[model samples]
Target chain A: MRALSKKWVALLGVLPALALVAFACGGEGEEGETFKIGVMESLTGPGETYGTVAVQAKQMAVDEINAGGGINGRMLELIIEDSKCNAQDAITAYNKLTDVDDVKIILGTSCSGAMLGAAPLAEEEGVILFSGLATNPDIANAGDYIFRTSLSDALLGVDTGNVLWADGIRNLVTITEATDYAEGVRRTTVEQFQKRGGQVVGEERYPSDTTDFRTQLTKLFNENPDALHVAAQAEFAGGTIIKQARELGYDGPIYGEVVAIGTTALEVAGEAATGTKAIITDLDPANAKGQEVLTNFRNRYDYVTLPWYLGSAYDNVYIAAECLKQTDDDQDADGFRDCLYGITWSGAIGDDYSFDQDGEVVGLANVVVEVLPLAERTQDNQGYRVLGSAPAE
Target chain B: MELPIIGDIIRLSRDPKDSLRLSRSNLEFWVNLLIISWAVAFAIWQGVGFAITVGTVFAIWAILSVSLNLVVGFTGLLSVAHIGFFGIGAYAMAILTSDAAYEQLRTEAIPTLGWPFFAALPVSVGVAGLVAVVVGIAFNRFRDDIYVLVSFGFAVIAFNVFLNWRSLTRGAFGIHEIERPAIGGWVFDGELEFLALVLVSLAVVILIAWFLMTSSFGRVLTAIREDEQATEVFGYQVTHYKLAIWVISAMMAGLAGGLFGSWTTFVDPNSFVLMESILLVSIVILGGLATIWGSLLGAMAFVLLEEGMRFLPFLPSEFVGQGRQVVLGILLVVLMLFRPQGLVGRYKL
Candidate 1:
């Protein structure tokens, strides 16, 4: 038995070293055949729902660009690595792309935490990290190399605060998930609300993985505030919060951010989700290109969880392809960044949205949308009816 | 006839009369030397970025695994709270080193000492050790499975503190752009330099673990592991032994966490989740529980396996992430079937 265990130990010791050699030898890839851009996405873990959509949308755009003669006659290939919606995996994904694959430009990272985790490394290495889904306000200052198509939660907070005051909500109560993105939304919105002299009656927080919010909800209801804000990291949490709030007999007006107003959240909350207003940057339904992108995405994937992120992700690929065309080199991160700074384009996300000096998206504003009745939900609008632009602060 | 290396290792702590066993163990030591030399050579061959990134990661995991082996493998304690110490160390590093990383983004001012890395690292390790001592004193009475449950509770509470302590940890948004270690004149900004620093730290940790394992104290630990009641009846204070080893193990894990935050230049609550603690336990288990070298080998294999899955060009990109997890599960199942004592473990949990 001892001898056999020794053999197993020897085998285990030799195997990993052998595998390393094999991996090292096989690391090289054919150069100049494709513009290999890295895609660091949360393809698994808590962010998978929207993350999967982001990946599919990017792939669809990559296929389209390749089919239409590639990025300047070289095929555009994305080396997708899952970040798993955390810092550790994001750093690992970033290192693999930059060190092993040697890609200069990376598009993705679905969650703000993942983006934040990888941003410092990208900034230090002079690699361009562009995201379509990450929306923490702090990302605006991450570095020159970090850019995103998503609107900053700071802007969303502003709109949300304005909408609250406009709707005559003076005293507000909040139940927020303990996460970077959710906290950003809650903090910034509260800042704006307090600046307008709106009093916050009660506040509660729950961890990201937690499902039970009854105690927190009871505490908030006891305050009997004029309005309640549900800031959740995941859609299920948002749905459950709304469902439970109704079950607790709090018929007061409830508000939330884009994730809370998502199709899946509404599906989870069912009838309870109706009349819940959200501040979100949504696509204009009448825009031809936007409709085309949405139609094609529906046709290809047969489902859309976060329509805006899909649009943003699709636009990111097109934007990247255009930058590659202008720079004429896949490795020229500087030239690509300059192209982003100089160019303005109309896309599915918005008409002629350009990046500011800080690489934050400009020319796009958030809107207030209300969840429709459960039976009235559609795949197109994701069960929400837009109530026009959010009132400006 | 006994196998040369295994027989030597098995008899290493006993039967000092076997000169052949000594010679064979020396050969095993040389083999270990050769393996490390090959790794360093490979790193040198693979440019600065790959070497620094992978090497630093390997160093971190190796430190964590080896130290965990001291508690779980040597002292017969199953600790799920090692990652809590790691997180504490990481947060200590972040809070001490930089302020602008999150201060600019946050509305409220979070205190940042902005101290140098080396200066702050000791405090981080000390804090982890202190917490471990406190928890050890409280829970040392409960042995077996109850100890595991209590330790698991510590990990969960630590995770919650990291997640909800907005003033201290910046909550989940994470502190980014942490400063690298620097001396008076020069900053260790280069990847190769940082990798070297981490490896040196890992070596120090391994040395400490070795010194502990070879001492009379180590023999007592083994005795305790073999039979706690017998050890206590022999007039040995088992709780003191357990607490001392636990503190040392936690401090080592804390040191690794500090290096990890410095390497990535980022720290967040998500990285220290219960799943990560479970992953650490898996690393110790896979590498072989009572062997320091096994921890090193196990970390290398686990890191390689996870990273190596990406090298397979044939795996469809869509299923690659899930495929990696599946392959790891299958490997563990196979290893359990073949080697129930782990790849080189002396004791079975």
Candidate 2:
């Protein structure tokens, strides 16, 4: 019995280590005709909807690349992992992609928390993790391997401030959803709002998934700030917070970042959602360039999973595939990484699309949209109104 | 294999001939204990080793369940608030062990707090116990049902504190990069090593609970549970006895929490929600409530149930991504309605 226990223990010990070794030392059984890129995104939880968009966009990019002779005659294959918008799960997925899948490049991570965790892991493991949705700058600094296509939380803060300024609201109250992503935007918005001569009323925070936001709403309403700044991801919490604020009898302008919930936020908040000032960075699916990509993506994927975020994702895959086309089929991690850094294009969002050393989208613009009469704004079958773009000076 | 006290516990906890012997009883217990210990040893010897992380989770949760069993099972008090207690220990130890990390993570400025490793453990346990003492006094008037509601309410309140107390707890983003514990020029840096510590601590806590369960006080607590009115009629001060056990259980929870915080090196409000407390109770109930061995077995089962499910990733990607808690919820319902006596019922049906 003792010997058996010892044997079991030894086997258990050796098994995990052995598996880890196999995973880390993955070899190409069929190395000939494919460049595999990992797409790690939150398919569910806080960022589920956005993740759907990212997934489709990534697929579109894959289809486009494969059609273009498959990254220099080698077809592009994407391995997808759903992060579930959590750090632990995101990290595990990240390790699996980099180690087991042996993906030379990554298109990834929508949730800020997921991005933050994954960014660090990617940096530690030296895998290039470029994301389209996570906005926090801490994510940018997590490692050299980390990069983002979305606007920085700091810049988003400034853009939101610009919207508030344009809308003629100078006194702002901030209520962040109390995650690193939301909190960073909240702080940045406050800094920019105050810097631009806006009077600050007060600030408060609530945990995510809170059903009763009455306590925080009561506080924000009592402050009577000219505008209320809601910093959150698009989800029930942000929308519900706005709805609760409205129910508390404050009908002021809502200056929101990405945290205004889904379009459902507008549906739930109703009249209160109107006059909401927001800075959006999503693709205008109706634009000639975006429409062409959207049509192609639809025909290719059988359905539009999420039309907006996926455009950029589609671009990312094509971008990586484009880079791979220039590299030797049997290059090392560093060589592949170098090729990834060198690619630039006129694709999905706009022309001269390129990444900086920090892996941030350079020369990007934020499109400011106002919550208007749903009838007037509803056009072209797209869910939102694209008023205009705001590029940072 | 004959020692009086050990023999008594085995006869009481692992009686194979009583027909109460669960499938794989002795073998399961010893194997689990051995595996758990081995996992911990590997983590300590290695570094936050994966298997060790699995083992640490079991040990911490098991010990936590045992501690909570004192309140939920013996005293018949219902408080989903133990997760809050778990949070307290985690937060307390984290604030101590990761003072530098806290300073970096928290936005607001606060005074630096640094304490020795041993000193932090006692402080965390003390704080959690003290809080439990205060909460127990206020909510002791209700029966278990209302008690659960009120306790759940308290857990929400604690969760709010964890989330909004940004200066202290860093709200929701989680305070990260905590330093490992240092003792005599050696740091407990690896998860396997950490797991070993967790197992030893879990064993010690369970042993203490075993001692308490068989003690005169344990009898009184059980008496109060089965018939509080009868105990009251018998001239026992039920409130005081209940409070004593609550405090003891809270200390145990705090100890487990400190170890947990140390191991994760990161703490967040999500870790302390009411559901976690409920999960702890489920483990205790599953392994036969009011028994120390039950708590240990339940904790092991709980961890295994959780980590084991990951082996078969059969769900569609969409369901797989967001379905963990949903599955847990269904399992809990099944366990509750079908196996009410629990896997190791105190008196098997």
Candidate 3:
């Protein structure tokens, strides 16, 4: 009975300790001495591959700014939160960043779903939610405070339509992943293609998690279109579709956007990816300044997947720093937003790219590129040889 | 009569008169009231930020857990389709209230009703409850592992329908700009205000659960749980009781989902996956089976523990997300070793 009582005493001591720990850990962080910017990204879920790279690039830029004597004498501090590439997690991450971290500026949310989810809250709260990679067209109207360095799918679709017509592909067959990004690209591309009097022979949409696309491809190929468009949200899906479509003996020229023709996608698809054309925003390999940025990134990270995303994410940090410098106050969201509207800054992504009235990036163009043959592919070149720019809509 | 850290909240007295009086049950009820009141008060004191956000989420999870506990804990029906009803309710809410446009199959527009919150939420609940009744009728014959497998299939099917039904749910694009609950001009837009609405709704759910559990119908459900054949022998029409409880539990989950849709102002297929159903089951099981108050405690602990992992000083910044998952797994494993019934659980699942 005495021993049991002693055990009970020990057990009874746990609740207050837990409460103490929670309260102790939640003590307010020291503020104002540094420029605190929050980053929300999918560090663990489906978007982790690009999200991790984006976070690294942002961190690299932050380090460089702090090393160059800290954003006007105050060091830059980033409070990072994982969105898990979903809406609810993004909202939670947004709350933590804005409420707990007391940050006025948030960068990221790699996935479009996460961006759309948190964009409403950030817009209503008057916080600057800037993204480097989210490309859904809905984000353009998400709010006044929403801005992205990434090109919207709306423009990509228009470029794709232009590319398809220019290449003399009159009848098109499309297979799209059922995601905001992929569907946005497919639907807008189809709309533009049809506007240009191009005929769509077949259209198919599979779920985001679909692995077997043979059935969808088989159905599409039955229509016997002149060209096929593969709209995929991730590298694996793009690669799988390309590889499987090739296996099914559809030899017509294949078309895709950035994700489907990305480095990882090319690697996954292997020789099957050859001759496939993609309209994507890419760093000009000939640009000395862009080359230097890529070199620095390679030296620091020792790897590169999506070089353009890295460059864009890097530019976002610099962009944020520029806005902060213009405002001279971390809390002045209106001043920062106005600064964004007025300023035209050049960085790793592109030169003289500024935000439009709707906060969409202006001045960057998507380039048409073709995947090189297996024998010609190199690690440095990442399996693609750049063609000239896509024709303007 | 005292019970360790839980104190007198869960004392298992052998006294026949004492058990009948259920004074300890009242103690548990009072403790739950105290905890919820403290949480609300603290969130208000802390102002509208992380605390209020977490508090709001806690109430929603508490509602889901308490309702799930009715089916899983009280009636011995292991449901993996609770989140499906949640999705239906959320979609119903979003589809009914929002004026968001979905371009239907490339040519025309799918219509949005744009009803107010008061009208939309009840319809959402009714829709979910109706679905539950249909599913419950179909699933009434199965038990144990078979029931679990079949219910899991239901969850998968529901998720697919949400994902592929582009005209209605807009596929993976999601329904956005869901309005906050409003009565005329008083919109529950502020975080604090929304949290209060959620807390009040949770209180109503708890009361309903309490009333149901304390009634003679609840005793019959418990009897059915203990021995279905014997309960049938005692002339208790076991299938009817099970179906009734299932519908009630599903309706409560639907209500939670409606609030979830409004609070986040967004609903997507990703939020209602099969894994979420398993998570709900874990929450109910971890909090202790057959105890309504245990669901409240379970949700509080789960939410706080997840949020608290963000504040772990030792974890490297890069590994924070992955590290949180790992640490949570380890802690849950340790907890299970110590108390297989769960933190305050009475049954071992």
Candidate 4:
């Protein structure tokens, strides 16, 4: 009995010490000479495809900045962590980044859930958590330190409404993935479309992991609206929805959000995806800098497909670099946050783009893209044709 | 070198049977108290705010694991839907106390009472217990494996309701700006204060669990777990005992969930998924079933292992997050192989 008690006591004594040692492992990065910026992406989950692209874009930007004399002569190092696109994982990743790695500026969080989970912690820790692709409207007011270069779903929803209205689609039915990203877009689009004198005939939502949309699509098809809006995170789901909707024999104009514009949609839906339109942040093919980025990304990755947030992620790294360059004290989180708030620059995405007080990117122009046949699509495009820029709100 | 009285106390604590006499069984009790107190003091002294926050979260998980142990460990019922009760308490507290609830009320043009955090606790507990009664009545018909399946289904259904019920639960967007617990104008806003609240709650929960474990009612539960048919032949209504214990366990889980929602100041459907329920079961199994203190140790070990993986220098930064789960999987396998009953558990699987 005494031996048993001693064994238990010994185990208890060792466990807490192990915890303390874990907390004490990571040494602080050298002051001012090497700026450590953390990156939290969903590297190995449902958001893996987009996360991989976003990380590549961020790395491309970081390499460019280093190649051009670095950020104020201090080499920028990115400490990347996976969020797994979940709130709990995001919090853990955030804690490690702030406490262990000691990074003040964080570029991350492709998913809305990840951003929301880390926002309060970032606010408390006084770290600047800037997202490359999180677009949930709730994030606009999440924290003073939380900012995003990507356009909010609110803006994209309004753009979708305006573009559909301009195209003379009067009645619409919406199908959304039951995630924060897709739901936010669906809600805002329905509201904005209704306010613009367009009628929403019906709306349906399904969980993110769901593969079968036959029931929902069949039901939406019964409404026989002028258009069907697909609000989904993954292109596979979006494409499946389109293919299944077409199989149901309702061929009215199909609209998609920013999430539906990638090559996955085309690959899954095949020829049925042609003529599908989406509201996407226009990447100007004519611009020299945009072409340069496109060329570099293609050469490095050997992948023709570009996810929606690739441009935003590329531009976010430059934004963080520019913010660090402008700060009087680069080491101060508050100073870096303030400098980020005040600065504006044109990059691969567009011109004169800056963050508003709520940390939303200002003057982000949206354009409508029509999925065209392989032969009709430009060499620069995967399967999309830029169908004129939408009027800026 | 030990004194006679101290030696006796230690011997009494190491005994497998539960005891109520403080003079005989105070060793385990005092050791647990000292370990918790020392951990709290060490976290604060380290002055690492993240460590404090993680410690508070650990306390919350400990509370949950202990409550779950009441049903799964003591009663031998594989109730995986404990997270359902947790979600119920969280959503109930969030809806009853949050400013969002007030706004929602105004939007619906309904009258609002706006319950405070403390006032909301009983409501949350009652709601969880009430739901447990309904589920328990329906589920008590099923035996062993079927019960596990039915209970797991409950967790999935509850998660869906929390996700799709936008009018009440706000669906996937989650309720934000939840008010932290306050006492006579002193809000528990800081990490230390929140940690203190969590620790106090854990202590109370441990006391309740200990009391129950050492009582006649607890012995009946153990009997039911060992052999329901034999226990029933002894003139006990097996269903009633099961239902009663289920309700108590659920109410305890609800209390823990209420604390969690307020501590994080946010509650989303994702926080209470089937994975979370599995995690609670793992905590009990790892700490050793039928042992109250084992649950606490299991929670500590689990949280420490998960968080400690972040500090492994051998793992590259990119692989560290996912690699943590890999290492944890290996550790659990090794533990099961070496110590199947659990590290401190007296019961055999």
The positional error of residue B328 in candidate 3, measured at the CA in angstroms, is 2.1
Choose the strongest candidate by DockQ: 1
- Best-to-worst DockQ order: 1, 3, 4, 2
Q: Which residue runs of candidate 3 sit more than 4 Å off their true CA positions?
A: A1-30, B1-48, B101-109
Candidate 4 chain A, run of 10 with poorest lDDT: A22-31
Local accuracy of candidate 4 as per-residue lDDT tens digits, A1-393: 555555555555554565556445534445557777899998766677767778888888888888888877888878788877767678767876776567788998987777877888889878888997888787887878999888888778888888878888898999998777787778777777888899988889987777889999888888879999999987889988988888888789999966576777777887788899988876787766777887888898787455447888888888888777777344588888887778877888888878788878897777888899756665478678888877443
* First chain TM-score, candidate 2: 0.83
Query: Pairing residues by index, what is the TM-score of model 4?
Result: 0.87
Chain B TM-score in each of the candidates: 0.87, 0.83, 0.87, 0.85
* iRMSD in angstroms, per model: 3.9, 7.7, 5.0, 5.7
Model 1 misplacement above 4 A: A1-29, B1-48, B101-103, B106-108
lDDT of 3 by residue, A63-127 (tens): 99999998889999888898888888899899988887788899998988889889999999999
Poorly placed runs, candidate 4 (over 4 Å)? A1-25, A28-32, A44-49, A67-69, A84-88, A100-102, A294-306, A374-380, A391-393, B1-47, B100-114, B346-349
Model 1: per-residue Cα lDDT over A1-393, one tens digit each = 456546555654654565566565555675768899999888778788867888889999999998899977899988989898888789878988998778999998898888988888888789999999998888898889899999988888888889999999999999999887888899989989999989999999998777878898999999989999999989989999999999999999999998788777888899999999999988899888888988998898777768888999999999999999999888999999999998798999899889999998888888889999888888877799999999976
Least lDDT summed over 10 consecutive residues: which range in candidate 2 chain B?
Answer: B19-28
List the lowest-lDDT window of 10 residues for candidate 1 chain A.
Answer: A7-16
User: lDDT value for candidate 1?
Assistant: 0.83
Cα lDDT tens digits for candidate 2, B48-165: 4345556667778888888888887767776688888888988888787665533343233344566656678888899999998998798777776788789889889998898888
DockQ of each: 0.43, 0.14, 0.38, 0.29
Q: Could you tell me the lDDT of residue A133 within candidate 1? A: 92
Pairs clashing within candidate 4: none
Deviation of model 2 at B224, angstroms: 2.4
